[model samples]
Target: MTLPADITERLARLALPSQAVIDGAHVDALSGETFDNVSPRDGQLLNKVAACQKEDVALAVFAARTAFEDGRWRDQGPRAKKAVLFRLAELMERDADELALLESLDVGKPISDARNVDIPLAINTCRWYAEALDKVYGEVGASPVDRLSYAVHEPLGVIGAIVPWNFPLHMAMWKVAPALAMGNSVVLKPAEESPLTALKLGALALEAGLPAGVLNVVPGFGAVTGEALALSMDVDMIAFTGSGPVGRKLMEYSARSNLKRISLELGGKSPQIVFADCPDLEAAAQAAAWGVFYNQGEVCTAASRLLVEASIKEAFVERVAEVAKGMKVGDPLDPSTQFGAMVSERQMNTALGYIAIAGSQGARRVLGGGQVLKETGGFYVEPTIFDRLQPSHALAREEVFGPVLGVMSFTTEDEAIALANDTVYGLAAGLWTSDVNRALRGARRLKAGLVWVNGWDACDITMPFGGFKQSGFGRDRSLHALHKYADLKSVSVTLR
Candidate 1:
């Protein structure tokens, strides 16, 4: 596994921390077991990390509950919490290169993306929540002549966050930063495939002067670590980002246990609709290619289904294919690689399996239908596109977390709307049109949590980000995220 001299030197200078961070200290698993940390970059074993189990999870949760009950963090004023978060964000910025390198090596994303996109976004997310901390206000309600009534948002005890491998650090902070800003302690379970950055962030949280037990990280498999967190009666809530099946199981765990609040950000088979009268076909094609190929198409809201007006279907797909072919696929540590390896061998195989299924189902492969760069021994797939796909085709309906796009054509506006909403997932959609009326109508009619106009995946911290229907409920980004980590209390007082 060859890397740039600078990156190689940095990797050597940094020592990988294997123990889980609990109660502001790094500790080994209670069971004394460890798992090999494999790099998708070259199918090499990076190191062994503690394979935490239920016993470890229990200890972490107990510590978190103790901290919350003792009011170590929960008792702090909003401004105080904000200051700590700001400090944490500063620490992240200072160690930006190291964090970016860890994320790239762990998740197989391009180093440029890890540095420029993921790290910056995560830093901003933390800073955004920190800045908004003291701005949240309690609400006053209509009261009787002699009485006053108001509602205050109080922090929940403990938030159990199970983040996915796709955007390890960002997703963890999407839950962690908000929960902490709202004054809730958190126990995080990063995905088994990529736990390095989450562990690093946990250490950073401690270094930021966050109270002991306010943030804990248990790195292990979902079944052992995540399931334990979900089922633990001491946990106050469980926030997750993963597959629909796992999300459903977590909800079930919530019900069967103490009915802890559950916030899920699940899968999506999002749509990208392009009308014949699109304002800019060239830009639309570029956005369409990015929507499905960015992050190796592991994004939950990836625009996998492309619905174009029949008149411009061929031209639009051709344009998108050109952009796909132009993308650079190689070692993630490379500075110029646009696309990187899949997170793991399992995910790479899953993507290839879907490609094979598309061929057998009679869909025509327009471009990039198989694996590429076998010499590197890294998991790589071509930026794939399939045409002649029916709405009911499995390739169009299922969430294939890979760089595979399916193209379909529609004759009327109604048909396009219907096609976009035909799936159980309603995470996000993109619509391109020249007519103002059509754009407004399409945005209103689409059964998705977020609708992009002439763009895709252009999200900011201010906007509420989540999904509708089977894509799962509960928002992630905006001020709305605070609601999941808080409990509203209504108070009424009689005046003399």
Candidate 2:
């Protein structure tokens, strides 16, 4: 299909730097290995990035260790760190549009979303953690006679972060911001599918006054570079955002080594519950559509499971169907597009396979059961909806991580709560109701870490974000996230 005028302009305007930056120098991979970044929209080659390897990961970790031990970054006080972070936020804001375009091209998310939602939130995350660094308080205890006792927070040096492809830049910021704010250096490995923006951010961080070797970005395959980072004995902590199986492996590797401090934010199949008494059915329907379809429904907190009260199930399903039907799925750079292509050909095939499974399992297809606008050559799946699904159905239990929703009905409050908690993953859940008592009960009873009342997928930088159960542990945002990168030590001194 012909590209839209706006998309064409944006694509032509994007300028990718020729080399990857490492240790204050722009360089190529050690083996001269390279990988092509393809746009999901038309399978077009966007750019060629250095294909980093295990040796590269080791180099990155060593650089970070040196930065933490011998570099100026570790010697800077909390106030100085905050100032550097603030400057980083400013630089991010300045390059927002360019980064947004890169993110949209690399990940197949709408340019508008990359600009207005993802990039801004990422910058604000750094700014928020910057302000909180100096405010984190430690404990002081009463001592025995002629003794003084106090506690201090210290950084866990040389953190290793592995981020997924769906929101590459944003997830990188989520990991890097707090770790740097707490005085720890980082070695970041971006998913191979979407690594351009992360590499760009590495350069931008240097421009923002972050010292060289303090932050390193390596783009490579998971089995090679990613595994090396997780298994490295020199790395102090491992913070990862990815699938459950990989998270389990990371845990095992950490255990085998130094039992490194690990923080994982994994997959989810979150539920969006709509009660009969919801005051605004239209608003709930729209929120549900956006929650499930945004970024091609690749979000960890995507409301893939919709649990509606029996009385309102029919109407709510119809309303959501209407909204889904109206969404525009095409080129991501188009300003008018609401949805975009899936991240890659592999993800497209995976989503289609899930749809087939849903069909064979006897879930009724309410709307959008197939691909749309195939002439574009883009890996685009229709916004799909499956209704009358059983609680044990594969579609209901697993995270499709695509633009697909499974609808189920519940009779009572207990049933709704049970259905919501039925999944192994519990990253987030949404509750829409007019009754205050029911809302309160749902909020308390839901097993997920984040609960939205009368809305879905609405997040702020100040709120804590993580999951329970197989969805992984440890939070990402908020002041509490800073604690994940820090260690507490208590000291007692005798003064006679």
Best by lDDT: 1
Q: How many clashes does each candidate structure show, in the order listed?
A: 0, 0
> In candidate 2, what are the lDDT values of residues 170-202, reduced to their tens digit?
899899999998899999889988888888888
Clashing pairs in 1: none
For residues 81-127, write the lDDT of model 1, one tens digit per residue: 88899999999999999999999999899999999999999999999
- For residue 336, give model 1's deviation from the true position in Å: 0.5
After aligning candidate 1 to the native by TM-score, how far in Å is the CA of 273 from where it should be? 0.3
Off-target runs (Cα >4 Å) in candidate 1 are none
Q: At residue 34, give the lDDT of candidate 2.
A: 88
Q: Best TM-score goes to which candidate?
A: 1
Model 2 residue 243 lDDT score:
97
